[model samples]
Every structure is written in structure tokens, then in C-alpha cells.
Target: MSVQAQGREIRILALGDSLVAGYGLARGEGFVAQLEAALRARGIPARVLDGGVSGDTTAGGLARLDWALAETPDAAIVALGGNDGLRAIDPAATYANLDAILTRLAARNIPVLLAGMLAPPNLGAEYGAAFRDAYERLARAHDVVFYPFFLDGVAAEPALNQPDGIHPNARGVAVMVERILPAVERLIEKARS
Candidate 1:
């Protein structure tokens, strides 16, 4: 922890779509809640703001970023692009929107943990390749922490996901939190520093 941040609450903004919104999960079972709990468990005084919206795309995330910034977060987690991939939105558009989001956050001096997403398999190999690589590109360009594939251990697992197979169940959320906790810790350190 930075000397200046010794005793204050660390606010983290979580921006994304249904996965971040926890479409089917209950309030405490969502990603943000679980992540907050995990942070606290590690003795980190942090609050994660839920900026997720069901059905939101990268364009939507960009549109709402200003409002989200009103929270004045110390750090951010950008987890968008899932809906864009699901809808087969243009890779260039997705990349542009994400770049804008990261750029705006950087402008505010907020550290970020970019949660990545992959293109839906049915979107074709060429489209998938383009979509899958945008997050890494953005992470390198912006010099932010990156968690490639937000659904790492949970996606495509019949037991880990809800019946819709798109959203993770409570257990899946737990798994996600477990996998991303280290990165989040790093993000908090960045914020504190």
C-alpha cells in the first residue's frame, strides 16, 4: 500500500456487460460482490463499483464511462466486448471502443485491470482471431494489467454455467473471482502507488 493510501477505502470500478452485471445471479453472488469479498478477505480495504449492464456492448460501455467516472475510482476493471462478440460486431469497432475506454481511464490516472473476452465460436475463425487478440493489444498499448479471457475456468463448462450456458452460476462466479483476485490485487497496488 502506498503511504498516502494507508487508511482510505480503495474504490474500484468494474465495467462490463451481463457477466459483470451478473444477469442471472443474485446480488451477493455476482462478480463485483465476490471480488470485493475476496479483496477484503486478503485484508485489502477496497470497494468495487458495479458498472455492469445486462446486454451492454463496448459502445455502450464507452457511452456510460463518463457517468461511471463520476464515482472517481482509484482503479478500474474493463470487462466488455462479450456481447459484441456474441453479436459478431466488427472487430475494429470493438477495438476502437475499448481503446477509447482505456484512454479515458488513463487520462484520469486510474489504474486498470482489463478483463478480456473471446469471440463466440460460431463467429468463424477469422472473426474469432481478430476479436480474441484485441484485449492483449489494448493491454500492451495502454500499459494496464490484463486478465485474458474473463471466463477462463468457467466458460463452456456445463456444470459451471447456468442453463443459458452464457452466464455463470454462483459457483462459476466464485471460480472467476479466485482466478482474477491476484490481478485485482495488483490493480489495487497500482492504485495505491
Candidate 2:
């Protein structure tokens, strides 16, 4: 699964919180596993490492940055900040944490596909605005590929999510994989280049 394998196989790190971890889903039904299977079905062989930790905030991600980077992923899907938003953490702190994470990835020359999340409306408009803006700002600054909202089609869809109404179910993971496949493919190409 190492990136050193070159063109033979691309190893992508799926880093973030519960959604990336496929919380409450069965072993093979998780996002990383589904994404890998989808990539293979598309004739792209890849190893998607599960770097997701439930309830992980951008700060938590920053703390574990070294360990994640140790895997030497060819590229990464940075999906943190959900928990931060959930906890109503200061958006500036969230931005700083994500900024540091992106900087470290860039330093390692690992291309990234950042999966953004919007702040819940319950967090208040000002806080929501700041949180929502952070991802795009960071993506532009870092020149990384970005997916504006991770839960696009799945959000608010009860059938696609677990009872808790946050984490996606297996079917929802499929939809996500389908929607993000193109970006992931582009990420793989970027890594290859």
C-alpha cells in the first residue's frame, strides 16, 4: 500500500472524522473500503487507507498529522472539521488546524482532495459563514482539489444515513464514492505526475 510502488498502485489516505470512518457501518461497508472497491471497478487499482478517527477535530487531526504522514500516501482526502463544527469550536482555530495539516501535506508533496463540510445552521450564521469559508480559502491558497460539501446528496436523506442522522449508511457511502470518484481519479493522476 506504500506510494513507493509507483504506477502499479496508488495509495490514498482517507483522513478525517466519523463520516470518513463510516461510523456504525459494517467492516467492508465503510467509506474507505467502498471507495477502494469503486476505484477498482472503474479499472483504477488503489489502496485507500483508513485514517479516519471518530469525533476527530481538525486540531486532533493536526496532533496525529505525523502518524498519518508516516504512511507515505500518494495523495490524501482531508476530511476533518466536522467534529469541530459540531462542538462549535472557533472557526479561526479550525482554520489554523486545517491550514497546518494542509501545509504539512504539501511539504511532503502529497497531492490532496479536500472534502469540505459546512457548519450546521444551529451554530449561528456568523460562525457558520466563517466555518464554511475556511475550506475554500484553504483550498485556493494551497492549490488543492476540493469537494465543496462532503454530504451533498446524502445530507438530510434519512434513508441514506444512520438513525443518528449524521453518518451515512452503506448505500449513502456508495453515492458518495460515485460523486467523488472523478475528483479521486484526478488526485491519483496528480500523484502520478
- Top candidate (lDDT): 1
TM-score, one value per model: 0.96, 0.95
Score candidate 1 by TM-score against the native. 0.96
**Residues 1-193 of candidate 1: C-alpha lDDT, one tens digit per residue:** 4423466789999999999998998889999999988888777788999999999999999999999999989999999999999888999999999999999999999999999999988888999999988888999999999999999999999999999999999999999999998889888888887
RMSD of each: 1.7, 3.0
Off by over 4 Å in 2: 1-7
lDDT of each: 0.92, 0.90
